[model samples]
Target: MRDTDLSVELCGIRLRTPFVLAAGVLGTTAALLERVARRGAGAVTAKSCSVRPRRGHPNPTVLPWEGGLINAVGLANPGAAAMVGILADARRRLAPLGVPLIASVFAEEAGGFGEVVRILEEAEPDLYEVNISCPNVAEELGMPFAADPVQAARATAAVRAATRRPVIVKLSPNVADICAVGRAVVDAGADALAAINTLGPGMLIDIRARTPVLANRMGGLSGPAVRPVAVRCVYELSRAVPVPIIGMGGVTTGEDAVEMIMAGATAVGVGSAFYQRGMGALEAMAAEMRAFMQEQGFGCVSEMRGLAHGA
Candidate 1:
């Protein structure tokens, strides 16, 4: 019989496992999302979508680094209306796999975010991830939303009021006190918090051309290099807020996911690793997690949560 103990509950939704595909990467398309679900992710969050379609940044949007990838994909998407149709199809396909889909959405302002949330609310997504940070995008509103606690609170509160679904605020790691911002959002009614979106305003320069590697000049940093910071953010925010936390940064293995969970994340999101290992990576990681659990004699992932804190 299958080990049913891998299940985890996030934002009021039950997942078959604690593994979830982070927004962006291969999760943008319905076919790719279905492929990821079949490969064994407990849930999948679509690439961040906005009210209007965005072409995203120009080529050389992603650059490889020592332990991760720096990307300025600029939140490229076909807009919310088109995304709803795509999500509906993906949901139907995922039903057989019993994997939940969380829709990630972003907007330029509180009003815009509310409208986007309201529009997508009818799509019946398992959850809604309010992206308050996107370093690659050329918008003045994205990161600014979470730069301060008051703004973060207002934006999250607006989205919360617009939908009955769970609202998860995806934070930017570039902030000084992420916990303060996290607390604001949670108080604003966010059902959960997704910390450490990407670390940056970071840039890489080509020594030969003496120019920035990415056309956008600067992008969000993600991967193994940022894992430590991700852990700290998750740990601090988990203590400051009562909502569940989804930790993500450089998680590439079951051990990495376990670290985040132990640091206080109920679930973990994998992105750069997916690009590095492809869709099959999800299954590989899940298998590793099962083995780790069995070896440790833990029956469920919940039992492993925040063990670092002696909880």
Candidate 2:
């Protein structure tokens, strides 16, 4: 066995590995969350839920492109109140595995964010990831809250006030200045941040039928295609803010996670990778990270954080 340690601490929460099962990937149930935890995920985030249930987009919601995947799943969920049972069960399942359950919440308005948080507090999640960045819901919600510093802060502050859990604000890459948003959320009471929620609200056309592949027409691009952007956002945020960051985008391999860490991410989020590499990807990634660390003569994962920032 390699002597390298993959454990990481994010906002006082100790993670056995830096690999977090990013929100939205089979995150709707306690069974799914527990499955990922048993498979080696250090932490798992539940799907983003709102005050009320969402129908979400219809068929062809996700598609794989040459680079990665493009998705417009909309923010469909069972809603905060409905998810309490699932989240509570998930927390129970994950607790035995020594994994933390992160509940992600969103809303149509700033105050709605707190209302959702309050409803879901019964689950007692280890952390709350305020998803102010989902691009798929822009059409319904009117320009994602993450696109504006004021809106992002408002949403974050609402969540902070509703729960004592660590609030990790999820930011969008479609913004003009992610660092500004990062700073805003931090000042408003974010305990940590998750960057680059997806690149563009891009679209794909099915030339044969002359129609869009996704039912929603446009969706956020993710996977390897957006990894570079994710790294840049985390790098800038680490410099601009004084809180931990969860960097995610196109991260599929152990080396990818290591790169994210070097870019200043305290933890790396893995979502599309599960679809691309299966649930086993987490264990594989952790192994890959350990091998890389050993080969590079590093003793722990923290040693790789922000190495890219050095001259």
Candidate 3:
């Protein structure tokens, strides 16, 4: 493990290692984020912030099922203005370690996306992950914005115009055509893409209380169950667009990260795994990835990207 070459340079940013802390996973506080970075994340993504603050949904917002978790966090966070300060503090704290900070932002409309992007631009994160697909939001917006090509493009374009930072559009697996949305956003100006946000507005009922497990009634499903679907989406996106893909869904182990890379992801995002195994999962995944690559006679992650595209 000590001699494994697990490092990668993604979209011009050099990552000491390939494992990144996905959004909403220990990204709230600057101290916690620095700790995760010190624990061995190549980079960290902050939770989705918007132009306005949100209290999000009530208690019982997350449920751990047999193989995964369903959550309706509803993008709870301080507004973009407040988050910028946090991002600055994190960047300053992690500077000595040279870890990159990624800021993720979301909004209900294209204009709001632009506004949030502008507000966050002041924080100067290493990159920006434009989240257009949160299944836990209000019903009035209908499906996730990433589900529609027109909406995806509009939002992506707004953010692109607002910031010079590399923008990665996060897509939803619940869409009818994930590739279509990917193409739309990339065409609009996304520098990269993160495939397969959670799946399903799934539910779990509490028979005793005669109510749903989540206060929101339904939530997006994630974990091992969605890894296969994520692989398929990343594989398709690799062929559909020329941008580097950040693959996520159920990456809990190094083997899972390997599978994602072989499926065409330049980098792997581990979110649900945090809930399943805590921060230790990041190191475990990296170790597993190194072992698999070494055993397979591969020297670097670039060599394995898209290796499973046609297979």
Candidate 4:
């Protein structure tokens, strides 16, 4: 496996490998963030941040599906100011690991998103990911940011204008033509794209109560069930845009990671599966990927990228 090189670059940031800890899940605390870095994640994206702290939607926010998970965590966070403190501490702890940290911020509007980016720009994260696909908030008012290419472009442009740091636009799977939206963001100045921020404004129903399983009644669906769709999105967007892609959705193993890379994702994010396993899973998955690459006679992970495409 030493013959296989997993190094990859995203938005000018060099990663030891292509595995990244997805924005949600065990990414909320400094301790967890450090653990993920030590476990071998090339980079880490914090749980989505808002302008102020939120208690979230209250309990029953997540439900298990056959192959994925449904969650309406409501972008719950300690807010940007407090999040800066949290990130500072995490950075100090992770300094020795040399892992890149990508701050993930969400807002109700384009201006709000830009404000968060400008504020966090001082913290000097390796990159910033503008979360335009959060589905649990009411401010969305029936429309998701990533649902429309025009709106997505505006948001990307606003954030890009606000900061000099590399910006990654995380897209939603709830759109009709994801590639079109991706292209718009790229044209608007997105340095890269993280395709598929969960699938669906999905829901779970409780048979006994004859009611929705979540307090919010609707949540984003993730896990193995959305892998195919996520892969397809990566494939389509990679072909439509010139920017790099970070593909994620129900990736549980190294093979899953390689599949996304072949589908045109320059990197992959591990979400729900981390909840089922543990942070150590990141290292294990990387090891497995190295083994697979060696077996396939591939010298570098980037060489396998977009192999499924005609190029």
Candidate 5:
């Protein structure tokens, strides 16, 4: 962490590193987040949980594609009520490392977001991360909640009203105008933003089995394939919204993380990369980012953030 000058402050929470383990990866338990933090992540977002315990989609929920991987885990998790103990354990486990536990919540309905927030409030999460748009849910309307400014604002407002904890709204990239959605959520009281959730409700065919590879038929696309689009979203939203952005998509390496930061991400989310390179990926990214900074003669992350805006 020393070589990079990677420290950053999101909303009011401070992080020793700018590398965060994105939601829905290895985020179910406090132990997992603790392990990642000890390995070198600045923070970790627990898997997205709902008001009710969900089974999520069936088998073949995750598939490795050519460019990246597709997943429809259905946001499976113990309900918020059940997560209270888990969050408490996570809060305790991360306290020593000084890593913040960002509890990610997803609800089928707008009000449900607030309900889950209230449930986890007692657990004392360092931050509340609301997942307004997950492409895997079949029940969603024409677009995910992050696509509609109205829906995004409503959800953010619900979570904001429910907790005093800093709130981060993770937006989706499937929308035509993600900046509008980001701005709406910010106006609704989101303290920070995580740009570009997985890109598509895409699917793959099991030619050998003569059926769809994923049981859900479609899942969000993530990994190297989405980096370009993710960077674009971060770049645009960085200029449009005033809050900090946690950029993600295909950040598999430290250089990739640097690209995201230059595109306007205050921090970077390492998701599918977690699977591709394993836990060592975080450390690798930090070292690589530091080397890049040294070569470019930049003193810190802030100096490079949004550097692409003018380009």
Candidate 6:
């Protein structure tokens, strides 16, 4: 509110603020997407859909710990075909608000990435977030494309060929060198990047029940826990590639978002915070960011970006 500019351009898409609603957090429906947009999200990303429908893992798929939440939602979605209608509806609802809709997609194979993108093109989303790094579905989908530089590039290329829309390849933190995959995807024609989808296929147990907390037994860790890893990944990727980066993981506050921007993120992705707090989290984070910017004398998001990388 101090006239400090939060607007940032991501691959030609101008966001009113630096905070984007990360995919999979209340992104399954048009109403939910609209709600986040109304709540102050600069942009909204729909849940990751595939070429076909998925039942996803059963209940108890998400559990909260002292640090954060572990979830194995298994990318549950209505599939690409059905999602076209959902996305079109979301776009109509979002357009009036001047908020961009970013469609997220994932596939079990390289070519499948393109196939899904083509089908979803009917919805005309402003951007495509090619999710090649979802950690919760490794068993069903096999190793994530983000694990291998070659495979990451291949998936990125597939999505690139299918859409003229800017593509942001989501990366995983479970790899040896995240920068390797980052450079590969950029070389393969990705217009931008999003890093550290979630950390670990970590597990939790019910002490009394003597069973795993989540039915899937393993889930990706998110919330306050993964911010460090996310920041590091974004920092490395920002330096490794020339495109814009959407940094996310456990960003729960405006200070956290600012830390991410200083870490070299063009935009900050907000996910688990919505769960930890509520819809108000976005507004709170935005206020906090503005307060920090005003206090620091930073005029815009671009000025704070990569300050950690020093000249």
Top-scoring candidate (lDDT): 6
Better of 4 and 6 by TM-score: 6
lDDT of 6 at 212: 90
Off by over 4 Å in 2: none
- Full candidate order by lDDT, most accurate first: 6, 2, 5, 3, 4, 1
Would you list the C-alpha lDDT of every candidate in the order shown?
A: 0.86, 0.92, 0.87, 0.87, 0.89, 0.93
Model 4 C-alpha RMSD to native: 1.4
* lDDT: worst 10-residue window of model 3: 1-10
Error of 1 at 258 (Å): 0.8
TM-score (C-alpha, index-matched) for candidate 5: 0.97
Worst 10 residues of 2 by lDDT: 1-10
Model 4 Cα lDDT, one tens digit per residue, 1-311 = 45788889888878998988889878798898988888888998888898878778888887877877999988889899988877887888877887888899887777788888777776677788989988777544457789899889888998899888889999998888998899899999999999889788877888999999899998888999999999999999999999999999988899999999999999998888876666678888988898899888999989999999974
What are the models' TM-scores?
0.96, 0.98, 0.96, 0.96, 0.97, 0.98
For residues 1-311, write the lDDT of model 2, one tens digit per residue: 44888899999999999988888888988999999999988899999999999989997999999989999999989888889999999988888789999999999999899999999998899999999988998777999999899999999999999999899999998977888999999999999999878889999999999999999999999999899889888888889999999999999999999999999999999999987899799999988988899888999988899999996
lDDT comparing candidate 4 with the true structure: 0.87
Better of 3 and 6 by lDDT: 6
Q: What lDDT score goes with residue 172 in model 2?
A: 94
The regions of model 6 sitting more than 4 angstroms off are none
State the lDDT at 175 in candidate 2.
Answer: 78
User: What's each prediction's clash count?
Assistant: 1, 1, 0, 1, 1, 0
Candidate 3 wrong stretches, greater than 4 Å: 1-3
Per-residue alpha-carbon lDDT of model 1 for 86-187, expressed as tens digits? 899899999888899889988887778888888887778888899887776645444567778888888898889898888899998888899889988988
Name the better of 4 and 6 by lDDT: 6
